[model samples]
Target: MHLAFVAFLVAGISDAVDGFLAKRFGWQTELGAYLDPIADKALLVSIYVALGYYEYLPAWLVIAVVTRDILIVGAIMLSGMINRPVQMHPLPVSKVNTAGQIILAALVLFDQSFGLNLVKLTTITVWVVGLLTVTSACAYLLTWFRHMSAYEADVHSSLKQQKDGSQIKPRHFGQNPRA
Candidate 1:
């Protein structure tokens, strides 16, 4: 457990370091974009599973966390496979959700290490994490739905324009075609 806590701390620190380097040095790459999230998710999921197995956390919460990540990864894969890759920006609620999960995990590990008996804090954190997880999932789903709807509308509009012999084309500003 202690080793796990240490590893978690190291992972958190490394994430900050990598992010700083990416922004400061303009070292962002296509691979980093995908790898960073995958690494984070892998670490988080592993920690959650370990914690649950040891009875530090609830199994249902563990399932929820793992399920959410699976759903997200699955959606991203499906989108890419269909050649309609969606740009995923972390929503504010999702950021809060990540923070809540990190805090909860840290607190649980700390309590276990020192026998702090922080039941009240643990209870509050668990609820926050659970609620945020569900909300973040909903937010992502809603965004995906809206994006698909807009894309469909655009396709329909273009098809209609084509069939009506009114194909829209870009024109330069202050330029008239008949001039």
Candidate 2:
């Protein structure tokens, strides 16, 4: 348990430190953009699954977290398959959800390592994490749906214009045709 806590602390702190260093020195790269989230999710998901197995965290919460990640990945894959690739920009709610998950994981580990009975606090944080997880998933799904709809509409309009022998420009989501 102590080792687990230390490993978690190192992983959490190193992420922040690395981000600071990257920005401070302008070391950002495309590879980092892809790997950073993968690392974060890998750590969080693994920890959650481990804790859930030990009955330290609820299994359902772990399932929800994992499920949300799977859905996001599936959406990305589907978008690519249809030739409309997704460019994800993290939402504020998603950031909050990540924070909540990290905090809750730390709290749970700390409570176990030191034998601190933080049941009430743990319960509350867990629920908050769960709520944020679901809400953020919904937000991402809604955004993806809207983007797909807009893309389809633009394609249909362009095709119709071409068939009608008229020059018409189709606008994408958040784009102005007049501009």
Q: Residue by residue across 58-136, what tens digits does model 2's lDDT show?
A: 9999999999989887987787797766665677788999999999999999999999999999999999999999998
State candidate 1's TM-score. 0.85
Off by over 4 Å in 1: 161-179
Writing each residue's lDDT as its tens digit, candidate 1 over 36-126 gives 9788878888988999999889998999898888877777666668654566567788888988999999999888887899999998888
Clashing pairs in 1: none
Worst 10 residues of 2 by lDDT: 168-177
Q: Give the poorly placed runs of model 2, Cα more than 4 Å off.
A: 160-179
Report per-prediction Cα RMSD to one decimal: 7.5, 4.0
Q: For model 2, how many clashes?
A: 0
